[model samples]
Target: MSKHNDQIAELLTDDSFVRWINGDANTLEQRKWNRWLEEDPANIAVVRQAKKLNELLWFEEEQPNTQKELKRLESALIEERTLPSEGINRGGMGMALWTKVAAAIVLLITVVGVIRYAHWGPKEPEATEQPIMATTQTGYGEVKRVTFFDGSKIILNANSKLTYPKTHQGGDMQVELQGEAYFNIAHKSGQEQRLFSVLTAEGKVAVLGTKFNVNTHSEGTEVVLEEGKVKVQKTNPKDRANKPYIMSPGELAMLFSNKSNIKIQNVDSELYTSWKNFELKFKNTPLHRIADRIEEIYGVEVEFSNKSLREIEFSGSAPNKNFEVLLEGLRTLLKIPVTYEGNTIIFGS
Candidate 1:
């Protein structure tokens, strides 16, 4: 027999196969089924096991109502089909017969239900539930600017994900962040003012009306304040639970993951926020550090083949030029030969 026919037979007998049958099958599914049947001699054996389990569940004489029987059949089919292939013996007729019986029972039960309930009136539909909030993903080298319902704005950096409620909750305005984002929150009065919180890997940065930039990635969590103040608290603070740092403007907080240590530094807010205007400003930054920042901003990899070149420090501002121009400028300044292979920039002697 053809492998496809055998698989169909095996599937018919397997009890757990019901799940696959009832589940939605799209274009790829049909193609997969065709492919499976076309390949492998053991496909037929697997189908038989499914058929047998299905029959046992559906063919019971004392089976409940149509809906109940359908549910039972589905459950049994799933269980039987999921069984290990090693446990199935293709050489035996007992397995084949059992699968055939199960298949027959399920089919008969389904047929009877269809005949009896064909004229049954449809029931009123239940009240619709609120839809779940969908996650927004930013691809590599892509950035997105989104404005919230409350007039707050978020600028998502490359390769980031931002998930928020579909409908704003009155008690608290909260957003989950992964990667980097710059927020400009709108001022609100009364209880609404006290409810603004931005959740990140480090902790929750709570504010009423403030502007801040948060970077949460594999490297670490960084929060830079531009306007107003924000209270940075570790979501799971152990000892200093009561004391949360109130970050003011012109201050930057760095929370290192390797050690649960926090470092506060004085920063030039305008230079930090230069990316907002599509500019990369480097002030006495190491060549390696500059490469790291460029990789993060543009979602590209930079490799310095020469160890000596990696230690060199660069101090210059580069317009948000195209990748080629940026590379050429860096090469000219560092006096090193650089080549671009796909997305990776290689610096060599």
Candidate 2:
């Protein structure tokens, strides 16, 4: 092959060129792509050779183990590249040296191909090293009271998921949570000391076996302390070290996503944990926001066609009756007729 032909062959065999063929062509600019394809007719032949090699290696009856195959190929390439001494016979020695050099070139190409394939090929499934803990899920309009082996009690609200280990690990009690839950953790007395933690999407709450309630959804996360004290820290730290804020009883830790800021204030603990009793309490909460919470608790869809009603603020408690009855009460309070259609509730004229 000519020098230009050799260069074309090398480019065609490149892993990047293979990636372009394997569905990454969009990454190349239009002009560069056109120039590459128009380089030479021999380039097409080189591409075909690469494609054939790829098919032969990947489509065989049973593909070999990638690591083992690469290791064997490397050993063979090393043996093929070992040249004889200069003192050897000139005739056969020259032929042997050329053979070794040619073999070395081929081996180099194969090694490059192997490395690229190992990186871009179908990955092997990795075995899970740790066993998952027991998980509990609460459906819509449902609530569950769970008692852990360590004597901690958790009340999971509607559409909530809680996962905890079957057996308590020494030193700490940890539980992963999604949605809303009220926890009444029992204290453990020992020289080693015991810690309790609740893990959520926003962060993790660590306590010395205290009572707390955690409410988390797409909007944000809220931590309320009913008894004892707790420390809140971001699970995935943005800075090099995490900053934890401690909250005493009757305090609330509100984490908002817009500014990624945490606000701590004294709050009425009953307002936070009232959902456990099926009572909805709102303190200056927007009508639309209340509707959203009602929908989540009842597994229904709420639509406020009258956009004006969304700006209204509601403050009071509603009974834990069925959704229809609750809507009837709201209708009386707001002086607007609420209509229910299947699973959708609409607020309109």
Candidate 3:
């Protein structure tokens, strides 16, 4: 099995993880698993896979007698397969181990088959049976472009991931995002237009074909509209009851992690969306803010030799396609000493 399959198999065999997936874990176990997820956001994807597998394995509460089901499943596997030469034992212990491994591999194969069918299956009414889900990701200092079947496009920023369906047909369309992206949503024709939405851990942004930028961070999420309009809502209960904030072009909507209020203000959309064009526009933007961008894009730590250098402002544009190019431009434009030590970038002599 592949590394991912190995992870899923390991997770499936763990009692705590199984309980967590079934939502039967105690409060302490729940808290522990929650913390594990919060520590590394990437774990969420793995957990999602595990949950899907668990669901398909008849691990739900509706299962008619889980013990009997397991016995039937194990007997069927045992009858159909033989153990390896080394693990073969008359005592039945090896059979048990082989059964578990085989079950996980079967589940993996089922998932792959579903994806394959989505790609190559007949294009009749069965097309909607398996909605093809696609994922686009960019590593540190890397960017990616994703275009939907409808010609709508998204320029995903560095250290970002977007999970969306391959097609935008069938009612409202939605995509889940982690990190930042610039969206150029295409308007659907006809009198009834389908609503498009972007979902983040912070909240959701609903629109009807618009140009916008969404940035999700540890603190919260920010939506900057460049063209058309968008509606921003907060998922937190304290703010959920309130109506979503309707936004216009050149407007910014913010939802803070700790705050229950959704704040709206007018802003220059270019400053936020400029990265989509491989450029960073600074209008009296301070060095600290620049450092923040460098850290975010390059996945590095930034420091200032003198704290006051952080407050120094610059009004210019710099190429962001390459970290080295941006760093060189900053050095010449700021007329300051910029050096790198290990993975950390330092400004000031």
Backbone atom clashes (below 3 Å) for every candidate? 26, 0, 0
Q: Compared with the true structure, what per-residue lDDT tens digits does model 2 show for residues 1-349?
A: 5775666567666777667656566556445655776897766766676666655666437766999868877886666445333211112213344334433433443312211111112333542123246666554555678887667789887666677766544545567777789999888787646677887766778877888999887756799999988888765476545578899999999765443557889998987888877677878778898788876665668888888989788778876544545676777766677888866788867
Deviation of model 2 at 126, angstroms:
23
**lDDT for position 318 in model 2:** 73
Q: What TM-score would candidate 2 get against the native?
A: 0.59
Clashes (candidate 2): 0
- Please give, for residues 1-349, the per-residue lDDT of candidate 1 as tens digits: 4766665665665444544454545667656755775697665555455555555566546755899767877875774455332211211223344333433332333222111111112322431233244344443444567787778888876546666757654435567677777889887897565456777666677788889988886656788999998877665467453357889898988765554556789887765666655566777677798878777755568998978877777766665534555666777766678777766778775
Pairs in clash, predicted candidate 2: none
TM-score winner among the candidates?
3
Candidate numbers sorted by lDDT from highest down: 3, 2, 1
Question: In angstroms, how far off is 315's CA in candidate 1?
Answer: 2.3
Each model's TM-score, in the order given? 0.58, 0.59, 0.62
Local distance difference test values of all predictions, in order: 0.63, 0.68, 0.75
Residue 139 local lDDT, model 3: 48
Stretch of 10 with least lDDT, candidate 2: 111-120
RMSD to the true structure for each prediction, in A, is 20.9, 23.5, 20.5
- Put the candidates in TM-score order, highest first: 3, 2, 1
